[model samples]
Target: MIHDLLLEREQRRTISKLGLDLMITPEGNIKVVEINGVNSGSSGVRELTGRDIDLEMITDLAQNGLPLFHLGKLKDQVFPHFVSELSHQQLLAQKWMHPRAPQKTARFVLPIVPESSDILEGIIWNADSDYYVFNERKYLLINPFAVEHAAGDKSRVHALFQGDLLAPLRPKMAFVVRANKECDVSDFKPNTTYLVLKPTDEMIGRNVIVVPTEDVFCPDGSLKEHPLAAYRRREEGWYQEPNVIMEELISSKKIGSSRTGKEHNGCMRYLILVESDKGEITIKHYGGYWRLAPSSIQDSNLQRQLVANYSNGAIPEHISDDDLAEVRKCVDTFVPVLYRRMLRLPINDRPDDLPLEAYCY
Candidate 1:
């Protein structure tokens, strides 16, 4: 479903690569919890599985070419731009020293240097010359705006799930409301035991509040303090109501880790690559990895076991052959539906005025 949407946009001037964080229920149902665009992790998968997906990606790019980096002609020149509020020195150090740094394995691409980077609307400019500098080597920046729309916000995903195409694949959402507004706790589904409150665009499991529905409200007909604390810390004032999605909490199936000999609340990260060539589009499953929650399922803290995210201290686990086969079967079932839906939908969002050329440096 997401691949088709991304492909339509890629046919225009936009391109996207996806990393889906999925929760596999105890019943073997696959539910998508999050979709990451260009900022998704490939290095971590390499570190865990010893599979160089980055190399595969670059190889594919060279042959087919993505929207911005045409014909893989500039594959060697393109650099992954990391956007954050960190200081220039700090960012540079991370790019070079981080254990999972892409430059360590994907040597074709150079690390980014702050001195040569010039921030623009969607593209980065090299202040000194046409080439960007890192370790005294020159490279080009991938246009950030080219993949911006591919980064689906939670609200967008929620809205998409409202349609029949993706409804079955998404968890049951209770309601989507602005954080500052007074939400009626009674509106939640009667039988729903647990609910997840998540900010629309926050990543790495930040600002996500998961609690039992029964504890959502105080006895005196008021909202509980714990759930509201994340929202209150915003400096944008109380009236700045960002969209918050309240969905039924999907319990992660327990997977036993061979290394630890313990069962853990786990999630799966499946990477999907969508590439557009001369008017043709292709989609491929670039393999996947499993993430075990920081604590085991036996942990006393329910919240700690619920969020299985790498940034939140979760670690990667090897996916056994049996587990991989099961997931592949599920994904195979889902892909055809996605392709059928893509064929039915008209490409309406592509900008006709823009040239169908790569955004080269």
Candidate 2:
């Protein structure tokens, strides 16, 4: 569809050479998915737009610098071609609009999503929603990355589109909020007990997915991060972040490290997992080539032991006294500094594996 957007000749060449992908929404928003062989003459990168271009209106990029659109050919619905962030020099393109996530200010949920990764909460945001940019109906951008599904759920993680957020709910399970459901201030019922929520695809009240305040501090399990993202500088020295550690665990080789041989690089992804009496929990994010503490998960044998027990809803071991002390120290030291997103329980939908009696709001 980008070939039809009013684009410069250079932009078309750049998009073509890389086999890049672009997305246009029914609301006239545009997005760029991937761009390789970036334009060198454009000062490392550049953004092109005519203030706005109608995606359903045009089939080719426009060269006149004016938005080119053929609204007549588009479905009566509005269509956005793509969404890009404005930079002084240019815009970065993306595929489909960045979906919107529900974000409320309530500090209700305490425990949260606990890993570091680029998470995609399917089709949760929109251009015309009640967000910072109200009514304009645009895709969204979540600062930290994450992806979540119902707790204990074993179902397909479908990708939802922004234009279709209001469509009939198609959640794999009963967690979906029907498209016609309506919600107002009364939707948030008071919590008698501290609620714990498991991520689900369904949006609450209506077929709208909201970013719950539940502790979305980390992400839902560990997923692989791109190899090149290991280059951030921390206090100790050049180091990979906790999410990088999770990726190292998933990669073909040590993801963050560019070392030649897999000799004793000694990178391990282990943690002193903490669960609270209140059912709230905290994960001291420490996984890396440079470990801050000894490996709580010494060998694959121990890892297996923990996994087996966790499957049955049990804690693995006492956690060595030294390890305990180190974890305590780490929590005390970094809990305040660690990034966090508080989520309330039972906000989205019931978790499949979680006991209905427990973690209820």
Top candidate when judged by lDDT against the true structure: 1
lDDT of 2: 0.21
Per-residue error for 246 in candidate 1, Å, reads 1.4
State the number of backbone clashes in model 2: 66
Worst 10 residues of 1 by lDDT: 123-132
> lDDT tens string, model 2, 271-352?
2222121323344232211111112233333322112112222121222344335434544443221111111112222222
> So what's the TM-score on candidate 2?
0.17
Deviation in Å, model 2, residue 136 alpha carbon: 27
Q: After superposition, which runs of candidate 2 have C-alpha atoms over 4 Å from their true positions?
A: 1-246, 250-309, 313-315, 339-361
| Model 1 lDDT per residue over 203-265, tens place | 777767677776665555356654555556645454455567777888778888766788998
Model 2: lowest-lDDT 10 consecutive positions: 244-253
